[model samples]
Target: MSARLRPTSLPWSVYEHLAMVVGLVSLAVICLAWLPLALALRPVLRGDIGQRLGRLAIMRGFQLYLQVLRGLCACRFDIEAIDALRDQGPMVIAANHPSLLDAVLITSRLPNAVCVMKAEVMENPLFGAGARMAGYVRNDPPLHMVLECRSALRHGAQVLIFPESTRTPGYPANPVNPLSRTAAIIAARAGVPVQTLIVEFSSPYLGKGWPLHRAPRLPLHCRVRLGRRFDPPRDPRAFTTELEAHLRAELAGPKTS
Candidate 1:
């Protein structure tokens, strides 16, 4: 019985490793393929046309990548709730960052979404050019980030922000990190609502301390559900506190996958 089980388990293990490699390679190929086009469009097309095209391209690229993961990597994503926001007009999309792919999953569903990314990520060689073209705001020099996000909202682009500012640490033990006031401030200043998104993952793959090369449990699942939407705040500080409590309640209640 042990000898028979070994062969069966070995093949399953091999498949898991292969799937993980495929997922990573697919992401790299997509980014590399878009690099040159993003570079060319950055200087040549100035203003809305360039930014819109860049964002649309990114949305498509991410959509394709997710599809690849679904088909080839045996991953599952329940993100249809995100599509409802695509045509909802200018709004601040605030989500809990559980994993690195939080942005990717959300951005893949919204064509006009502009992300608020770390300054370093916005400057990375692999993602920087495309992000610049998409007019993604950098999360640094707080005032600058606020101004950029406001401008994007004014132009009818959905501003995607992670209130935690980074992935949650110690996860299940600490449902979420302390919320930042940036999203609330931006929404208030821009006169846009804050649409909260709750992203749940079956595994901690690509999470705060997860190793990049580690093979995640096969058939990993991710689900994004709509959460409470707060109107443009009259007082951002108060709103931040409310938002933080709301997230904690939602994330701590149950696991959905």
Candidate 2:
């Protein structure tokens, strides 16, 4: 059976597009504004302090953007065990990429985290500068990513990685993506565990291949449920298999929006 497609009302479509434009303009204003401050402090700020300033700025921007989304629609978020994950150190928080906002959501909340991002995001006008200043690791070679994550973990920072590598061809409403072993390899080397995060949404508004103009059900609801941490085994293959199995089971168990 084909998925029922609802016609988007013209008024709602206009509102969404307008809201997104306004929000993006505001974000650009914020990032551009901070660029000056960063340059001004270039002489006085060095290393960690400079990076902290950048992290703080980006974190605030992410939170502010989420608030904008909330104001535009009836959007709600349900997060569990996030606070618990914050306190833990040197752990890999394996996340499922269902929407474009997953990294923003995770990094914004876990401001101390080191995220593995694609090379393209590093060049993104809206996110690149902040990411570079925050000392985020680029998703280049898997080995390089692993080393960077390990170092961050040693420094008591949580590392966030999307095992799928990119947005899956089908998101949560479809079959799950294959789990990458980079995270497992890093965890095994660093002696940390991989914590799974399941992101469920009431609508696939920002899901894979979804256009920004596609308005989802009003008051879009998103939930994050934390799953058990897996200890990496001596055999990397075994660890990867276990990680995939665990995630498949948890993500398949229920739907939460």
Candidate 3:
């Protein structure tokens, strides 16, 4: 898709109300179908079958959401790294969080992406319902979450995480959350490299006061650029510092960031 040069604007309240309705309806549908589907087929499915089903459902749901956003609210996404994504393995996909739906956007585009979400999401009525079905790793303590992430990748799952921990309220150069050492720690223990994605969304409609129904007159643009992977140091503190410096470097030089 081509980049949208012109910027657009819409009332935040309208989008907010519309989003609430959509979310409620979507949640109801997910709950109604999910229970029956889980009971009827989980026992029948075996081995990679369950994984495949989970992957499909999650991807399909995410894609549908993107499509709806594009069609209804003028949101458009452009994903890069098509070539590198083909040669897949247990990858640690780490990214900066610019928007609330950044994780969902990544999931919609990547295959077999095992997401690391907060424990609260598992309890959230609307999101938890669908996320539980997708089998995302919970945001437990560092040790446990790391082990779970490693296991998922060892099983051919591509792991996606936001090292920034939370979305940036604005497009600031620095990350909002203190850079967590967890990502590097886990990668080093798993003996794997980390793939970096710098995600940016222009004309965001889903932020603090924004809504889903508010369509931007100008199209929204979001991009995920894949960066080279690197090995982590054995020492936890050193690994964390190196990863932080590397991420800062990637965000440096005005042309890219």
In order, what is each prediction's RMSD in angstroms?
2.5, 4.4, 4.6
Of the candidates shown, which would achieve the greatest TM-score relative to the real structure?
A: 1
Question: Which sections of candidate 2 miss by over 4 Å?
Answer: 1-10, 38-44
> How would you encode candidate 1's per-residue C-alpha lDDT over 1-257 as one tens digit per residue?
24653424877678788998999999999999999999987999999899999999999999999999999987899999999998889999999998898999999999999999999999899999999999999999999999999999999999999999899987656778998889989999999999999999887889899888888876789999999999999898999999999988899877754
List, residue by residue over 1-257, the lDDT tens digit for candidate 2. Answer: 11342226666556656666665566677778776665566456767676667777777777787777677644677664476777777788888888876776766677677788998888887667667777678889778877888887887778889887877666665636887788888888898888888777766666778886555655467877788788755677788888778777877866764
> Residue 145: error of model 2 in Å?
1.8
Candidate 2: what lDDT? Answer: 0.73
- lDDT (CA) for every model shown? 0.91, 0.73, 0.66
Candidate 1 lowest-lDDT run of ten? 1-10
**TM-score for candidate 1:** 0.95
lDDT of 1 at 201: 88
Better of 2 and 3 by lDDT: 2
Off by over 4 Å in 1: 1-8
- Pairs that clash in candidate 1: none
Question: TM-score ranking from best to worst?
Answer: 1, 2, 3
TM-score of 3: 0.78
The model with the greatest lDDT is 1
TM-score of each: 0.95, 0.86, 0.78
Q: Per-residue alpha-carbon lDDT of model 3 for 9-88, expressed as tens digits?
A: 23454554464456446635655566567545656664566756866677767777667666655555776453366456
